[model samples]
Target: MDHAETITLADGARIATWTRAGPAEAPHVVLLHGGPGLWDYLEPLAGLIGDEATTHRYDQRGCGASSPSDEQSVARSVADLDELRAHWELDRFVPIGHSFGATLALAYAAAYPERVPAVGYVSGVGIGDWRTPFRNERRRRAEPFAARLAELSVPQRTADEEVKWRTLTWATDYADLTIGLRAASAMAHSPHVINQHANRAVSFTDADQIGWAAAVRCPVYVVHGTADPRPAANALQLADRLARPRKRVVTEAGHLPWIEQPEQLRELLAEIVQAGRC
Candidate 1:
């Protein structure tokens, strides 16, 4: 059983929380979680790599144990990814992202496919326009969503009260967590990291991400729930425009497919990772 660990970014900010449960020298796989603030998501994912590989999960700054600062940017997060790879002395490794994390992974691979071994995006989102397909569903769903938000304990909530009480849940838990949102919130409490991750993500865009997405030169597989309300469709739209070896769509699941359907998701991911590793 490997243990958890932490690392500091160049800014001297302690921006990571991770778990290592497989062979230390095996293929290194990094899990990029959603929630600009959330980062702690290794527990459930630890099992996937088993003895075959090494897996690490971490929180973005301002979430979990990471110090909060005003230097947040999709570009900075991308820099953080680059920094982590260099810090780990990794010449190449697989990068996987869930929802917002998925988008980041895509952006990362797009920018540095040479360094990224392979990529998998679960319930991925893009940084673009806001869609409230459920705006009225908010009438029917807002109360339940808000109620769920209020139900979270402090560590699970972000630093902001209303977001802790509102936005985080809508973005991550709109479906089911036991496997999804909770996995995402492994970073900061939701109001702080998770909600902030979402707030920053939906609208996050870097000229690099767009250029990178267009130039992604490797295998990219995206898994999303057919039943997933918003991000699911968005995942498909991005997939359509992507180059060959790009897979998009995971049906019969919702936004939290990694947890809602971990085994299947893991199997699908395994195939893509293997292909990329080849």
Candidate 2:
């Protein structure tokens, strides 16, 4: 991927966006990263599908290199996505969202179904409440690494400390801790870069209330790792609610399937692109 370009939104917030040049007429895909406040970590997955589509990935407003704002909300994030699409001059595109990004993507599609040809929800936070299940799953998986994780999570942390904290916590998101650590290492290092206000605001909002799946007019492809903490049952339920949906459950993967099952993910992405073209 090339260096990011700055796009100033209507509200004057500048978002950092990166695009991988591909065939002019290829399908366009915009990747939404998770963590209402987390930086972009989807570059590896973008690289895997670069030849198939004109890929675009960005640090959403108030995250990574994007300008921070106190007005951050799910509504604002969805608007930012629309702004991005307009900036790219794309009449329609496919959105591939991971974790919380999936929630945002669904919201975007709900608000403007005509702009989205299809969606790829990878390890998505599906409909209904996921907090209780996620907490329980995290505790169950973090038991083995509790001591080390506890030591890493302090009140105030330096950049390296934040990286260690994120790495330790995210390590459980994979079937293998080693792979998880390696994957998490690519995450943004500075805690200062994350907007806690935005994270808290979006977290408290209910994505299901938006009625995005029901409003969706295009095919939705949902992928979940069987071992992911959010639960595969949620994905199944979400697929059932959509107008048209397809799903794949990767047995050995966890939250970040792109890290654990890149080849399989690439194939799934290719399928989504083809489906969109159809």
Best by lDDT: 2
| Ten residues in sequence with the least summed lDDT for candidate 1 | 186-195
Instruction: Give the Å error, residue 146, model 2.
Output: 1.0
The list of candidate 2 runs beyond 4 A from truth reads 1-3, 188-192, 204-210
lDDT of 1 by residue, 67-167 (tens): 76667777777888888788777888888788778878888887787887678777766434425663443334445356555566355534555444444
Error of 2 at 211 (Å): 1.1
* Per-residue error (Å), model 2, residue 103: 1.0
Q: Identify the runs in model 1 with alpha carbons over 4 angstroms from their true place.
A: 127-130, 134-198, 201-203, 206-209
Global Cα RMSD, each model: 4.7, 1.9
Report, for every candidate in turn, its global Cα lDDT versus the true structure.
Answer: 0.64, 0.82
Query: How much does candidate 2 score in TM-score?
Result: 0.93
Residues 67-159 of candidate 2 have per-residue lDDT tens digits of 877787888899999999999999998898998888877788889988888998888877566778988888777887789778877889877
